[model samples]
Target: MAVADTRHDDTVTCMAARLLRDAPEEFALLGTSMGGYVALEVIRQAPRRVRALALVSTSARADTPEQVASRDRQSRLVEAGEFDSLVDAAFRGLVAEQHEKDLALLDIWRAMARTVGAAGFLGQQRAVVGRADARELLSTITCPTVVIHGADDRLIPIEMGAECAAAIPGAEYVVIEDAGHFLFREQPKATASAVADFLGRVDTSH
Candidate 1:
C-alpha cells in the first residue's frame, strides 16, 4: 500500500518494480488523479506484478497543449508565492459549477490543497503534464482493471473513463452521478461501494 505524490512516472514505476521484486506474490495498485497515471505506468512496466488496478478520476491520454500551458501558468503562480490563488483556481476547476457555491465543498478543497501544499501541487502538475498516452498499453493489461470517474467531473470528463474501459477488455467502469472531479470527497460512499464491488468480483475470480 503506497501513495505516490505527483512526480515522474519513472519514480513511481521504479518503486513499484522494487516492491514487486521484493514481494512478487502480493502487490496491487490503486491510485487517483496523477497517482492513477503512475498506476497505469506501473502496469505497463510490470504487468505480472500488479495483481489488480484501480484508477479514479484519471485519463489514458497525455495532457493537451492547453492543459500543459495552464499547468505551467499555475506552477509559475505557485512559485511566485500565490499559493492561495492557485488553490482557489484548482478548486474551481475540480468541482461542478453548482458545487462551487457550496461552502462545505470549498472548505474540503481548501483542506486538500493545504495538505498537498504549493510545492506538492506543482510537482504533481509537472508529472501529469509530462505523461504519455497509455491507450496502447491498456490492451495488454491482464489483471482486473477498474476505472471510476464522476459523471459531473469538470477536469476529466466521464467519457475519458469510458474510453479507458473500452480499451481495456473486461475492465469495469463506474461513474458516480452528481459528483465532480473529487468524487471521493463529494460522493465517498458511492465511490467506496463501486470500488468494493469491483474488488469483490476480482477477489472471487481469483
Candidate 2:
C-alpha cells in the first residue's frame, strides 16, 4: 500500500491530496483522523478515482473554534521545543479510559510522534485547522463507504461518525466498544474485521 507524505508542507491536506495524482487509476481509500480529512479532500478533488472508502475515528465537520485554538496551542508548544510535553498532553485523549496506562500503545504513539517531528506535527495542525467541512460532499458519494468510530471516543464523538454514515447513501456505520479515538490501535482485531468485511463486500460486488 502507498502512503501519502503528510510532512514538509504547510498545506498538508492539499499536499497529500495531490499525491493521489500518482495513485492507481482507481483504488480503495482508507483514512483515520487528519488522514480522514485528507481522504474527504481526495473525494472532492477526484471522486471518480475512489473505489471504496473507510473512515476511522474521524469527523466530517470542520474544526470548531475550540479545536482551532487547541491546535494553535499545540503548534506553539512544538515551536517552544516542548514536543514531548505536547505529545504527553495529547495521550489521554487518544485512547480509551481503561487503556490510559497501556504502555505498549503509548510507546507506539511516542514513536510515531518522534517520526513525525515538531515541524511535521505543526504543519498537520495548521492543515487541520484550515480543512473544509465535508458534510455536503458525503451525499455525493456513490462508492461503497464505511464509517468506523470508537464507542467511547473522547476526541471526535461517535455521533459525528454516525452523521457521516447517514449522509452517505448505503454507507455502513460501525462502533467498536471499549475504545476511544485510537480504536484501531486499541481494538485492532475488531477494527480490522470491520474493514475486512467492508472490503470483502466491495470486492464481491464488483
Candidate 3:
C-alpha cells in the first residue's frame, strides 16, 4: 500500500514509475486519477512485477487538445500565484453535481491542494499532459486487473473505465452509482468493497 510520489518530477510519468524500482518483487498496484497514469507506466515498464492492478477514476487515452489547453491554463494560473483560485475552480470539476456544496469535502480537498502546493500541482499537470496513450498497452496486460469508476464521474468519463476493462482480458469493471471523480471519498464503503473483493479473488486465484 505504499504510495508513489507523482509530483517530484515535472516531465514524465516514467519518473514516478521509477520510484517503484525497489518495491517488492511482486505486488498489487492501485491508483486513482493521475496515479492511474503512473500505474500504467509502471505496468509498461515492468509488467512481470505487478501481480494485480486496480485503476480508479482514470482514462487510458492521453489528454485531448482541450484538456491539455485546460491544464496549461491551470499551470499558468498557478505560476501567477493564483493557486488558491485555481484550486477553487478545480474543486467544482472534481466532484459530482451533488457535492458542489459539500463544505467538509471542499475543506479537505482544499487542504490537500495546499499541501501539494503550486509547484507540485504544476509538475503533475506537465506529467499528465505529456503522458502516452495507454490503450495499446491494455491488451498486453496479462495480470489480474480491475477498473473501478464512478457513475457520476465528471472528470474522466465512466466510458473510459469501461473501455479499459473491455480491452484488458478478464478485467473486472465496477461502477459506483452516485459517485464522482472522488469516488472513494463519495462512497468509501462501496469503493472499498469492490477493491477488496477484486483483490480477494486475485489472492485466491494466485
Candidate 4:
C-alpha cells in the first residue's frame, strides 16, 4: 500500500488513477486533512481501486469566505518572510488546548509549514477554496468508509463528520475527545488505535 501526497487536486487525482492502473489490487487509502479531501476525490474518480477509506479532519464543502481571507493573509505573511509566525498562527487551531503549550508538536507543525513554503501554501489554499461540495459524492461511495474527527476541531466542525457518516450508508464515524484538527499529532495513540479497529472490522467484513 502506497501513500500518495499532493497538494493539488488534479495531481492527486491523476496520481491516484495511475496508481490504480499500475497496481489495481493493492491499496487502501488513509488521508488526513487536505489529503483526506484528495482521498475522497480519488474515490470518486476510481472507486474500484480503493479497498477502504479513512477520512480525518476533513469536510465535504469548499472553504468559507473567512477561511479564504485567512489563507490570503497567511500567504501575504509568508511572502513577507514571516513564515514562522504564519505557521504558528495557522496551526493554532490544530493542536488541543492542553497541547497548545507543547513546543515539540508546535515545532513539528511549524517545520512542516515551512517546508511547504509560500507558493505551495498559496496553491493548496486555492485548491481548497475552489473545491466542489463533496456531499453528493459521498452517497456514491460504496467502499467501507471510516470518518474520523476531533471533538475540538476548530477547522472542520465535528458535526460535518456526523453528517458525512449519516449520508454514507454504513460509514463509521469516530470523534476523539480533547483532540483538535491535528488528531494524529495531538492524539496519535488513540487515533492509531481507532484506525486499527476500523481496519480490522473492514477486513473481517470483506
Question: Per-residue alpha-carbon lDDT of model 2 for 137-194, expressed as tens digits?
Answer: 9999988999999999999988999999999999999999999999889999999999
True lDDT of residue 74, candidate 3: 88
lDDT of 1: 0.78
CA-RMSD of model 3: 1.5
lDDT of each: 0.78, 0.88, 0.88, 0.77
lDDT of model 2 at position 54: 94
Give stretches of model 3 more than 4 Å off.
Answer: 204-206
Worst 10 residues of 2 by lDDT: 8-17
Alpha-carbon RMSD, each predicted model: 2.6, 1.5, 1.5, 2.5
lDDT computed for candidate 4: 0.77
lDDT of 4 at 44: 80
Residue 46, candidate 1: C-alpha displacement in angstroms: 1.2
The total of clashing pairs for model 1 equals 0
Error of 4 at 106 (Å): 0.6
Model 1, range 1-206, lDDT digits (tens) per residue?
Answer: 45554432234455445545554464667878776777887787778777778889988888889988987888889899999987877787797667787789889888978988876777667667767788899898988889999999989988888888899978988888988898898888999999888878775222
Model 3 lDDT per residue over 1-206, tens place: 67776667875555645657657778899989988888888888888888999999998899999999998888998999999998998888788889889998789889989888898998888899999999999999999999999999989999999999999999999999988998888888999999999988876233
